[model samples]
Structures are given as C-alpha cells and as structure tokens.
Target chain A: MGDPGRDEPLAELADDLRRMVVETLCHAQAGHPGGSLSAAEILAALFFSVMRIDPRHPDWEARDRFILSKGHAAPVYYAALARRGFFPEEMLQTYDELDSLLQGHPDMRCPGVDMTSGSLGQGLSVGLGMALGLRLKAIDARVFVVLGDGELQEGQVWEAAMAAPKFGLDSLVAIIDDNQIQLMGDTATIMPVEPIAEKWLAFNWNVLEVDGHDPAAIVAACAAAQAVRGRPTVILAHTVKGKGVSFMENTHKWHSALVTEDLKEKALTELCVREVR
Target chain B: MVEMVAMRDAYGQALVDLGDRDARVVAVDADLASSSKMDLFAEAFPERFFQIGIAEANMTGIAAGLAVMGFIPFTSTFASFATCRAADQIRVSIAQPNLTVVIGGAYGGVLAGKTGKSHQAIEDMAIMRAMPNMTVLAPGDGVEVRKAVFAVADHDGPVYLRMSRDPSPVVFDDSCEFKIGRAVLVREGRDVTVITTGIMLGRAVEAAELLAARGISVHLLHVHTVKPLDVAAVAAAAEKTGLVVTAEEHNIIGGLGGAVAEALGEHRPTPMKRVGVADVYSESAPNDDLLQKYGLTAGHIAQAARSLMERRAAHAQP
Candidate 1:
C-alpha cells in the first residue's frame, strides 16, 4: 500500500461525498442519512485514496474489495462510487427509484460494488470470504469492510472475528463507524456495547482507534491495519451520528428519516457543494 | 428386495468423488462432519475441509465468503440448524445475491429417529423453498442422491440438498436419471396419482403395489426437487387421474403436499389429499414407529389412495 499521501485530497473528496449523500437521500426522500454522513470519511478515504479499483474495469480480478457491512448507509457508498467514476454521477439521483439498481442498500448490480451486503454482521464474513478467494487465486488483493457501531451487537460479527484470526487473514480489515447511535436511540441506552475495544481484542483481532471524520487518521488506520501480520484488524472509528449536518448530528432522529426539500437545501449549502460544482 | 442405502451414505460417497474430481470443492462442517457424511470428503482432502465446530451461522457465513473467493464450498449440518438457525445468513449473504453455494442439510424431514423432534426438519423444505434463488432437492434414494449431488455442483445458484439419516429402500436403479425441478414418472397408472418426495418414495412405491393388488391402477410421480415445482407434470397427473395424493416425511402444510396442492389448485383443478404428520411436533421414536404414528407408512399411503378414490367415485354419483 502506498503512503496515500496528501490527506487534503481525501478531505476535499469527503466533503463532496457528504454533499452527494445528502442530495441523493433527499432526492429519494428516504434513507439512513445519519450513518451515511458518519461514514463519509471512510468511504472517501477508501475510494479516493485506499482501495485498488479501476472504474473502467470494475470486475478486474486484481481489484481490492470494500463491503458496506452497515448497508443502510448506501447513500454514502453510492456517492463515493459515482464520484470515483464507477458510474455517471447522474445515476445517484435515481436512488431508490422504481426499478433502479441504486437500491436502498449496497447491491452488486452497481459497478465497483464487491459484494451485495445490507444485513448487519454478515459483511465481515463475506469480506473474509472474498479475501480468502483472492488468496486462492494467487492474487495479493485485500478486503476492506465498513460496519456500523449498532451492528456490532450482532453475534455473527464475533463469529467472523473468531474465524479470521484462526485463518490468519492479515489482508482483511474491518472498520467500524462507532457513531454511538442506532435507529431507535443511542447505543449506550439501547444496547451498551461499551468496552468495545477490549471485546475485539478478546476475539484476537488487532484493534485500532481513530477519529472517524479525520481523513489522515482514517488513512493511517487502514495502513496500520495492512501492516499487521498473522491476524485481521478492526479499526474502531468514533464518530458523530450525523457528522456534517448540524440538525442531525449526534441525534437519533436522523438515523433514518425522510429528507424534506428545506433540510436538503440547508445541508447542501453548509457542505458548499454548489461552490465545488 | 432392493438394497437399503442411506441418502447420507450416498452423499458421503458423492462428496468423495467430487473431492477427487474438482480442485475447488471444499467442505465446511459445524461439528456434524461425521453425521452429515462430510467426513468422507474431509478424510480425502483434509486441507480443503474446515471444521468450524458447532456454529451453524458462522459456518454458513464462512461458506458464503469462501464461495466468493472462488471455492465451491459445501457447508453441511443438521437440516433444522441449516435452515432455521442460520437462515438470515443464508438468505441475505447467499440467496439474495444468488451465490453459488451448495448446502447439504443431513437428517432432513423425520429421518433423525431418536434425536427428538427439534432435530427433525419438518419445516425446512418450506423455509428454503420460500427463498427466491434456492433450489430445493430431496432425492428419493441413494441412486438419486449420487446424481443430484453432482447436478447441484454443476448448476449455478443457491441449492439446498436435503438428505435423510436412515437407509431408504432403493426405488430407482442407476438407469433412472435425476434432474432438478423435473418430476419423474415412477410408475404410470390410470386410476389416481401418488406424488411424493424424499423418503416417502419408498412408501409410495409399496403403496402403489398394494393398490395394484386391489385392482386399483395408480399413477406415481416422484418429485425430487420441491421448489421450482414441476407444475406441468402435476397438472398432467391431476388431469389423468382427476385425483391427487401427496406424501412426505414432513408436515403436510408446507412440504410436498403444499407444493402439489398449490400447483393443482392453480393449473389442474383436481381434488387432493395430504398424507404426513398432522402439524404436530414429532416424538422421539424408532424410525418405523414414527412413520406409523405419523400416518406416513406404506399402509397409510395406500389407505389415503383408496379413500381419495372412494371420495371421487362418490362425488361422481352425486
């Protein structure tokens, strides 16, 4: 993996992707905006700086894969893919539309999508499978997964955690967007998954802690995860529920909600998407 | 008498043959390697086998991942755990995306005689057949099991292979071909049609012989694949006999009975009767005793055939 130098480019792309997430969800009028906004840095960093993907050849065997384990955050994932030229930017508006490939969650039908994931706690296993598949083919490519903090409550995540270490999958990295909020309410009250780092450590995973919104920090965490040997790494990315949007940040209401035109305008203007365009 | 061979035994031999033939054929088990008959494959290719202990959900997830990695992973376990326990993992990761994974659910239906009702998967066929991309197969005997296993490996998509614990009497010879979704015409008769799947085939064959002795000609159709139901053949059977009877070692509500009823209801418009456990949790009994208690024996099937014929004849008079 290269240094992925120039965190400035990733930061710039993160802002653009955040705008896209807001705009796409607003156009759809329904989606998980909170988690989407929270995962902006992770998606931008992976697509723009980290993952080995070619827009022209999405099915290239040598390409590294990224699975959105917290699949409700499709808006953010789609925005990153579109901006990375996997498909035309115009297709983002057709999200959740009738018969649109832009499903409410990540679908493999779209270009650059590795595995179709939306169900919580399943992606880490899928990514691990792909990583192993790549290895069998003598391809040195790795798998990167982005999961939600609330999703960690699922038991299969730990099952995957247990298997990855035994298999010695250093090329697999799972980053958790620990936004501390879920659909119903805050995670601490709903399901206290605190002592999270130690929980992963107990499962024999190499854990990395980082501020999820920091582009440079996210890049470094990914690199650190790759450098490790004989085990899988899970980066615990602490983040605000709704990182960029002022009204939604750290609140449970925006875990998923209909984006009114007025709220859309405010979010877009704040992100300065018009200036970038 | 024809030889009695367990479907799982056939599956074990099939997996060994597959292991030798295919490089990518890998087996993953949830501590049921020996029971599910995957021990044969494991012994052949130790490195290709992954014994994940007793975690069905993890086994399923890992199999799906291995499938993506370019390995044709055959995950095996008890039918109940494979269908109900790890259902979501199989549905979301494997079914929705149409992953090419073959899941062998051993001791399917009521074949696990003494393991209690929970181990018997009466609702498994219904559960798996409900999934969009799943190909549900419950072969009649060892002959069909060997053929079905290789067929599923070549066929693309999510397939659930249901195998029984006890040795079902051989109903077909090697000359009999097995094809997914195509109902085989076991014995052609003119009076009434007996449709069955899995272990019920042996009982149905016996029932047909019994009916033949009574001067009642019976049309028998063995449906190995439950899902992608062969509605055309069922309709033809319904049209020919004007009456249908379905049998299985499962609940009558959603297994072979339900599939045949649904098909004849829509296409053929024939009167049908279901013969199986009457929607109750089966008890731990000897396999033969359980069959007799559950109204799934050869005698019960013969009785169902006679009763359906009497009903049809009486209705004609009225």
Candidate 2:
C-alpha cells in the first residue's frame, strides 16, 4: 500500500516466486515447502527492489551480499535468484539432482549465492565477517542474512548476536522468518524464542517487525534498516508456515515433504499460475 | 644444547610478518589471544585483528565469511576448542567451500603440560587430516612454524597449523627448505628409518644420535605436513631400511604413526613400531615427566628403534 505503482509489480513477483517454488519442489519431489512458501514475499522484495546486484555479474566485488542462513528454504531462494536473471529459470527443473548447480541447499557454486550456507545459526556470523571485510576494504556495501525463528535455538546464533553489536556492524541486517514451525513442530512447542523483538533489543540491535507476506512492508522495513547507523538491524517478519495452498498452510507436515502431482496442480491453481505440464 | 624457541611465539611472529606484507591478512582469536600468542599479531595490526570473545564456533564462522570476502583470516585458539568445539563450523563453513582460512591450534599435543587432559589435543592432527580439502601442518620447530604460516597464507585452501605452548628445541634453520606435502629427509642411514612429525623431530634427531653411538644407522624423515602425506617418501624409506619407527607426541591411534603405517601397509610392508602416547588420557604433570611417562622422549624413540632392529635381526636368523 506504500506505492501502488511499485507495489503492484512486486506483488506480481511475489506470486511468481511462490509459483516457482512449488514448481521446483514438484520437479525435485523432495524439498522444504513450508518454509520456502512462507518466505516468498521477503525473497521477492529483496531480489527485485531492496538489493543492489547485477544478474550477469553475480561476483561483482562491490555488489551487496545475501546469505540464506535458513538454507533449508533453498527452493524459494533459487526461484528468486533465477527470477532476477542470476540464472536461466529453466535450471529450476534440475533442483537437488546429482551434479546440479541447484543443490538441495544453497552453495556458492551456483550464481548469485554470496556464501555457501546450509547449517543454521552460521549465517549471521558470516554476515558479520563480510561486513567487517567490506569495511576493511573501504567498500560501500551491505550484507543481508535471512534466518529461521526455530534456528534461533542454536547457541552460535546468540554468540554472533553478542559479537555483531560489539563490532558496530551497521552494514549487516538479519531477517528472521517467524513462520512458527520447524521440522519437528511449532517453535513454541519445541523451543520458544518468543519475546523475539525484546531479545534483539536487549542484544543492542535495531529491531523491526512487519507482516511477512506484504511485499511493500518488507521493502519499507529493509529501507529503514539501511538508514540505521552504528548498529546492526533484525527485522522480525510474522508469517504462516505454509503461506499459500489450502491444506499445507500453517502445517509442519509440509516442512520437508514431497509435493505430489495432484498437490502441485492444486497449489499452482491457488497461486493463479498456468501449469505447463 | 640446541637453540630453543616456543612454537607459539614463532607462529605469532609469523602472523605479524604476514600482516605487514599483505593488507588482506587478518587475525581472529577466541579470547585466548595472550595464551595462543595471537596478541603479537593484534598488537602489530590493531585494525585487522578481531577478538571474538570466547566463542570458538562464532570465531570460525566469522573467519569463513572473511575468507569469502577475499581476506585471508587466521583463527587462533587452543587445539581442544578449535577442533572439537567448532568442528561443524570448520567443516561446513570453511572445508565445504574450500576457503583459504588458516586455523591456528595452539598447545597441540599433551605438551600444553600440567594443564591436564582437557587442554591437550593429541587427536587434532587426526581430526583435521580427515576433513576433505583440509591441509594439516604440525611444524617441528620455530623455523618450520614460521615457514608454515607464510606457506598456508599463499595456499588456496583450508589449512590447520598445530603448534605447542612451551619452548622445547630448534631443529631447523632459515635455510632449511619447507614445502607442503614434501617430507624432509633430515638424515640418511641404512639400518632403520625413524619418521617423525611436529615437535617430536627434536627427540627423533636425538634418538638417531643415540643409535649412532650404539653402532646402529638410523634414517630420519621430518614430516611437517600430515595430510596429503608424502607417501612416496614413506614407502622409499621403508623399502630401503626394511624397518620403520614412527615417533610423535600424540596418541599412536590415527596420529602420524597411524598415517605412516597406512601408507607403508599399502606401498611396502615392513617391520614397524609406533612410539607415541598409548591411547590414554594423561594427568597434570611437568613437561619432561609427561614426555617420559608417555614414552615420547628421545630415549623411548631409541628403544623403539632398537627393538625394531632386534625383530628384524631375529627374522633374518630364522
């Protein structure tokens, strides 16, 4: 609602992101659909509007860096990267296959992935390192790390949290996809990280929150984070575990399950995508 | 007496020198800067030094990120924490991407002395050598430690540089050539071969002298690089002497002893005896007493060589 002119296209891109994730997971028959679907808008907003990157030169020295720390949601990351012209969209068909550039998790071998990440609680630390390196080189750039709420249980995440503020890394931003569910069950049932905003504020970070499915709000939040100085930022995005389809929404069953052909058709119909096959 | 310099001090000085030469070189320490001797580098380049509190896992992950951004990051901590505490971080962040990050593991082996089993890292070499794309280096003396620092900086992949806490002995000089994957033939003899790695080289050299006094010829090979081991050199030494002895200040299981045995087992089967800690945790003791108790002193090496020679002689008579 911030700007209808720009918001309309990003909303379209968000739908395209969700459709591609469903299609990619359908082809692989094995992926984490719940988290991938939940992150559609956040990925769409960053790849399309918030980030400064060149699709052709993914390794440009001065380009802004992005690391998918919750790397299990790799399908959505690949879709967004492909949609941004980092690679041909057709490569999505080879996701998770042997020798495929689209690995089950994000790998640096694939274009547009700044760092190879799959392990949880590692991305924020890596982002802090990148922020430090970029500052040392006098490069004007930012490092963005996307994390999962459930992944907050990892002690290393708090270790990084305690260190980033000490370094005064204003160029680093961490986005927590508060999708509520993990591989086991809801984060509240497994291990609660509730009071999430208070936790970040206590750790000396500039905290922000938004409806994760709202592309306009995500863009605004990212811009606000960029404007902050002297400290890192953490944006808590409230989202459903499975944001789009009917049966899969807010369920852990689709956290890392196979998407059947019929389920794929139903999901595509919900996202308003014309299924090719 | 041979000139003595602490391996940690040499490693620290090497970092300072590297920082002076390359602007991209940086150091990360996990709150053990003074103990690990990384404070020397921190003092030299304050802007490039990063003290990551006491979190080894976070420090390692941060180093990986620095490596990704084209900076050569050296992370230092005690061997026990560097390898075991941050193991998954090292494996996933650095080794998986084959990043050019050097891990400085200080007080490696039981030579952290008097600190007891918790501080010692007798299995560090085995742990690092097993990781894919990891280059493991256990320098024997001050000169080799310095050379290894510059070498791993220029190297394109991950490397773990194991160092000791105390000053023991200096076995090599600046003129001594040190290269990754190339074992140095410190001495050549005919009767028996005593292959040594890390600080054990000093005792190995002394052991050779003892054998010489007893009219026994000993061949000595000093292996500074453990992974991508010089298999050809090990095989040739075993082939010539027909008797081999591996001496190390670590558990004989999966240490240099195990590596040498595996190489010789495939290339040339020979009569062998491993001289090292006998796969048991050691208690707090003085350095000398611990070395003697674990059969890692020069005398123990000599005994192992003599026993191997006796076995060979007995076999020949039969």
For DockQ, the strongest prediction is: 2
Candidate 1, residues B34-125: lDDT per residue as tens digits?
89889999998987888777778888987888887678989999999999999999999999989889988899987696988889999889
Among residues 3 or more apart in sequence or in different chains, the pairs in candidate 2 whose N, CA or C atoms overlap within 3 Å are: none
- Candidate 1 shows a clash count of 2
Report i-RMS for every model. 1.4, 0.6
**Cα RMSD (angstroms) for every candidate in the order listed:** 2.4, 2.7
Model 1 RMSD vs true structure: 2.4
Q: Tell me how far the alpha carbon of residue B1 in candidate 1 is from the true structure, in angstroms, after superposition.
A: 2.6
Quote model 1's TM-score for chain B: 0.98
Residues A21-42, candidate 1: write the lDDT tens digits: 8888888888999999999898
Writing each residue's lDDT as its tens digit, candidate 2 over A141-196 gives 99999999999999999999999999999999999999999998989999999889
TM-score of each: 0.96, 0.97
Score residue B249 of candidate 2 by CA lDDT.
82
Q: Pick by TM-score: which candidate is best?
A: 2
Any runs in candidate 1 off by more than 4 Å, and if so which? Answer: A1-8, A273-277
Candidate 2 per-residue lDDT, tens place, B75-119, comes to: 989998999899999998999999999999999989785889999
